[model samples]
Target: MKKRWIVLDGSNIMHWKGNGADLATVREVTRRLGEMGYVPCVVFDANAGYKLNNRYQDDAELAKRLGLPSARVLVVAKGTIADEIILSAARDQNARIVTNDRFRDWADQHPEVEEEGHLVRGGYRSGRLWLNLPDEAP
Candidate 1:
């Protein structure tokens, strides 16, 4: 059987303000995803590494703290587009995107996200992380 994968929009999620975007929030999200049997792969904007300079040694360290393998966490190269890279990776793996972004700009690349179950959204409720997938609708 094919393994289920969840592609995370790291940049968008990390900036989710008070929602499911902080370091602890992301860790919780990953834990939930793992419990559900989905492999969570995260992709971040290249600048994410630089922004964390004060917090950790480098992006690798940050990823490690998040319980993510270097191979599973990708930092796009400078001048590259994070959204495009994320979309490409998700398309290649046939994974569902876990983000709050509407991705209006990348509609051409992911027209199917408008369809049910193609995109997954994350939210916090009662101090707990919750995942909402279009597929979960009855």
Candidate 2:
């Protein structure tokens, strides 16, 4: 697997600024990650559209917001948890997951959660997007 592959927790990142679900934050982050030479794979919960647009939106709609192809943007199936999907994608792709969540509950099953630089955490402190991606991996 290529080390440049990165998984983004779209469901969590959208709330980076605490202003509610904002796709702009996701878009900017995706753009920045791309600039840094990482291939972004964004995973969102099924209700992400409802939270952002007050209506149901498909993968294609959210993909447009992230400026990525529908294949790269995943809206998990209904009744499925997004965190699980995010972690699974990271594992499957041999990539790191970008999220503020510690995933303490899954630590027992996914020990990589405790590894350094495994769960890259970042958020906006003053309207500026920040990510803790390691220089080597990012």
Residue 70 of model 1 has an lDDT of 74
What pairs collide in candidate 1?
none
Where does model 2 exceed 4 Å of error?
Answer: 1-3, 136-138
Candidate 1 is scored at a TM of 0.84
Candidate 2 at residue 107, lDDT? 95
Candidate 2 lDDT, tens digit per residue, 1-138? 555899999999999889799999889988988888899999999999999999988899899877899999999889998888888889988898889999999998889999999999988766677788776332
Residue-level lDDT of model 1, residues 1-138, one tens digit each, is 678988888777775556433565666767778778889888878777555443323447657968988778877777899889888888899888888887889888689678766678877666556688543421
Model-by-model lDDT, in order? 0.74, 0.88
Per-residue lDDT of 93 in model 2: 87
Q: Candidate 2: minimum summed lDDT over ten consecutive residues — where?
A: 129-138
**Residue 92 shift from truth in candidate 1, angstroms:** 0.3
Q: Give the TM-score of candidate 2.
A: 0.93
Residue 91 local lDDT, model 1: 89
